[model samples]
Target chain A: MAKKLALIASKGTLDWAYPPFILASTAAALDYEVCIFFTFYGLTLLKKDISDLKVSPLGNPAMPMPVPMPNFVQMLPGMESMATMMMKQQIADKGVASIEDLRRACLESGVKLIACQMTVDLFDFKRSDFIEGIEIGGAATFFEFAGNSDVSLFI
Target chain B: MDFDKEVDAKNLNCPLPILRCKKGLNDLQANQVLKIMATDPGSVKDFEAFCKQTGHTLLQLDQTDKVFTFYIKKRNDAL
Candidate 1:
């Protein structure tokens, strides 16, 4: 039997969005049956249009900056947007696939995408807000799949 | 080395190359080999791990002028 991978995605920063999609696609390529449970802020990643995703430098001192930046500088208005654009440029230059591409790959490779039902309601998201082919479920649904997974991760 | 098919994953990073390699392998019959070319710096280890997990064989990995070339033989049992 193929191995199974269960991932819980709880964060939704532009930087944080890559992991669940990347791991799920690669695991699918490796013939593993994979599923991702997106909750809280992570549900934002499944939105039909994700152009607004932004990476913030605030409180994330480890984020690379072209020039040394103080915490106050990072907190300035528009800094988060600037940082996000710059990081997107860097990712493009590095030939990294965009989050949309990776997510598409995950779906094409048969990785199951599940959105937390409570989170959807909490965030006031309609089912139509998400892209096609996703199921909505709660924690128990996550455990049902995770219980049989060979690898389970919370990202 | 000889191969039945070739996939160009050039200028793509990390999992793109790996995913392309998987797709290439999927199209071939058992024992057929797929050749992949990638420009990702991490392709060497990435392909190795991919082959390891998927039961494919990495026949050769070569690098010349930053272009990485790998030859992978599909697993005997692969569909």
Candidate 2:
């Protein structure tokens, strides 16, 4: 009896891009139908370059302080790598599955994974760059699908 | 029991654990139970809201120290 949920994913990194999938998965777990639309940096999720996804530290003033240094300074050296490791480990430690694992589960669970057509064009990405089974559509189409959803999240 | 599937999501942050649990339950029958073990504090609120908004039954909720457990029985046929 669960209502549907639309999760909009916009981030690039595994750390920043997990919310949409997480929310959609949970909604589906609750027996609600789920849909996820990946736009902008969120498209990186379906790419093979998943490991290269990282938060841009330069303009991000709120990046968590590593030690006593300012966030700007923390962006130096291997900070991105450190952050990625920490985030990945945290997700794993929490007993949550990996992005790839979750992605597979989602496919099997009937979660609709959509790639934003505008974003694909904006980034000049070839269709081959994305995963094989995703549906490519515009915002209007996505919204149409999401119209009756009881819950919607922009992650 | 063979009737239930468990998803351990303890110590996880918002969304992923919940997402994993969701995927785990999606394939279950209407009366099947999906047990979720989570440690994120947000889960308490997130799952509550999820059930309310989705119309699923949040059959039981248990929390201890860093562990949070949820028992959700699918009821799509009743929808």
Candidate 3:
């Protein structure tokens, strides 16, 4: 039997979104069965409109910049959008896979994408909001797979 | 020095190189080699781990300039 991997993806920022799908796709490529549980804000990754995911640099002193700026400067009204644009530019220049690309790879490779049902209800999201081919499930369903996983991570 | 196919993973970041390599290997016959050229520095170690885990053989690892080249031979009876 193939090794199983379970991942909980709980963040939605552009920067935070890459890890789970990246790991899951790679694991699937490596012949491991992989599943990612998208809960809380992470569910945004599965939304039909993923083009608007943004990264915030506010209070993130470690975020690399052409010139390091103070938190006050990062807190400026337009700074978040600026940071998101910069990050998008960097990603394109570096040939990094966009989150959507990685997520598609995961799905194509048969990685199970599970949206947290409770969170879906809590957030007042419609099932129609997500892309095709995702399951809606809660913690018990997650534990069913996570229990036997050879590798489990909360990303 | 010879490979049945080549995957141009050049400039692609993590998982892409490996993902492309996997797709390339999938199209090859057993023991046929797949060569991958990548510009991402991380692909060096990533390919190593990929080959190790997938039962593919890493025949050669070479570098010239910024490119990292990998030659992988697909496993017999590979899934």
Candidate of highest DockQ: 3
- Score every model by TM-score: 0.96, 0.71, 0.96
- Which residue pairs of candidate 3 clash? none
Q: How well is each residue in A104-124 modelled by candidate 3, as lDDT tens digits?
A: 899889999999999999999
Q: Order the candidate numbers by lDDT, best to worst.
A: 1, 3, 2
Q: Residue B40 of model 2: what lDDT?
A: 83
| Candidate 3 residue runs with Cα over 4 Å from true position | none
Give the Cα error of residue B2 in candidate 1, in Å.
Answer: 1.8
The CA lDDT at B8 in model 3 is 97
TM-score ranking from best candidate downward: 1, 3, 2
Cα-based lDDT at residue A138, candidate 2: 92
lDDT of 1 by residue, A12-116 (tens): 999999989999999999999999999999999899998888999899989878899999888889999899999999999988999999998998989999999
Question: Weakest 10 consecutive residues, lDDT, candidate 2 chain A?
Answer: A56-65
lDDT per residue as tens, model 2, A1-155 = 45788988888776666667666665566667888999998888878546566654555666564555565666688977776677666666766667776676677667898999999999999889987778999999789878988888788
Report lDDT (Cα) of residue A91, candidate 3.
98
CA deviation > 4 Å runs, candidate 1: none
